[model samples]
Target: MLGYIARRLGAGIVLALLVTFITFALLSTSFHDVALTILGPAATPDVTADLIASRGWDRPLLVQYGDWLIHALQGDFGESVYTSLPVAASVLQRLVVTLSIIVPALLLTVVISTFLGVWSASRGGIVDRIAQGISLIGYVVPGLLLAIGLVVVLAVQLKWLPATGYTPFTEDPAAWARSITIPVIVLTIGGVANLAAQVRGRMIDELRRDYVRTLRTRGVSTGAIVIRHALRNAGGPALTVLSLEFIQMLGGALIIENVFALPGYGSFAFNASLQGDIPVIMGIAAFGVLLVTVVNLLTDLANGWLNPKARVH
Candidate 1:
């Protein structure tokens, strides 16, 4: 197990470095005038040149990336080109807000999707059809439209939750929950739509295998046979789907955050991009890669536990 974990961790670190390098190269090379973008049109030539030289934007891309990476390794991600605040601090602060919504929604997605999948697979008639229909609707709908519609009905009509705003969890727990309720619901629906189908399909395949029959013939109860044997076997593929779902939700969060006026990592990144703030953009890129790496690592560990064959590879 230790060996397996070390391998996965090493792979994740390598992937992180590779992704950051690519992102840094693209961001660095894509712009003709980084200083002008940040400093604006009215700035004099000397000011632009000074900004360029001071930030080492005048240096080769490789040298700049190397310097950035070295600082990043020591926990310095530079400062926002506009606000001048530390990039890491801004990213981490917004990350907490994003996670507050994402974490709960994902937990709910897992529980609800797993149950619906397992139950539908085991009872293969009306139950299966209903579950499939709901998932299909969810899968077909765009998250942006869903979020807007939800805000209209839930917040505008019902006045049950706020229309578009975020409250800090530390400020008021109840308001915080209310603030995130619609966004979380939007994300959860999309997540369950994809993951439940994967779970159901995998569960159905596992249930049909000969091992399942063997377990049943051995006088094991139906629930025990399904939960202890079939679910475990099916979980490997389902876990893969779940991890991909998480990454998808993070990407989709940009739309959701804008619709709901939430101050999250997505919003932060979006504003930074609009301003062409290279430092903030690079910081966001690095953090995103790290997050993906961590998620993939967790999925690998879960898969290894569920299927020892995974560890062998």
Candidate 2:
């Protein structure tokens, strides 16, 4: 198990390096324009040239990447072109806001989806049909539309929560929860729908397997067989679905952040991309790759734990 975990971590590190290298290579090509954007239209050509040289944008791509990688490893991602703020600092600050929504929403999604999925699969009648209907409704409703509807009914009309703006949790935990409630709900709906369906399908399949019959014949209680054996087997696919949903939520945060006027990495990254803020963009890209690598590694570990056969390969 230790060796398996080590191998998975090593693979994730290699993947992160590959992704960062490719991202750097792609972003470097248009870096000259970034220099121009920083200088603005009033700057002379000589100024732009000097800016490029000073920033090492005039260097060979490999040299630039090497320099960036060295600084990045030291936690110095350079300064934002427009803000002059350290890229890592800015990103990390916003990351907190983003995760506050994503983490809680993900937890709720997993718990609620697991219950509904398992119950539906086990009960199999009106419960199954109702669960399926709920899943379909969640899957089909676009998040933006749902958010708008919620805001109108709950915020505007009802005056229960703020329609926009974020409060730091440290300052006011209750207000913070109220501010993010709508956003979390919008994000969780899709995940619950998708993951619940996957879990239901997998659980149903696992329950019908011959091992389940063998367990029954061995005099194991129905609940024990379902919970201890079938659920464990079904969990592998559910965890895979969950990891993918997490990645989707990260992307989904961009729109949600903008809509709700929250200070988060998604909105920051989006703005940086539009302005071609290379340092900020690179920092976000590296962070994203690192996050994905970590998530995949954890997923592999969980799968290995749930099914020992997974560790063999």
The top-ranked prediction according to lDDT is 2
- TM-score of predicted structure 1: 0.95
Residues 92-178 of candidate 2: C-alpha lDDT, one tens digit per residue: 999999999999989999998898889899889999999988888787898889999999999999999999999999999999999
lDDT of 1 by residue, 1-313 (tens): 7876788789888888898889888887645466787777788999988987887877988898899999999999999988999999999998888888899989989998998899899998999999888878787898888888988999999999999999998999999999999999998998889888988999999899998899888998999988988899999999998888889888877888888888999999999988888888988988998999899988988888988888845
Clashing pairs for predicted structure model 1, backbone only: none
Superposition error at 305 for model 2 (Å): 1.6
lDDT for predicted candidate 2 compared with the true structure: 0.91
Q: Which stretches of candidate 2 lie over 4 Å from their true place?
A: none
Question: Which window of ten consecutive residues has the lowest lDDT sum in model 1?
Answer: 29-38
Q: Best-fitting candidate, measured by TM-score?
A: 2
Q: Which stretches of candidate 1 lie over 4 Å from their true place?
A: 30-32
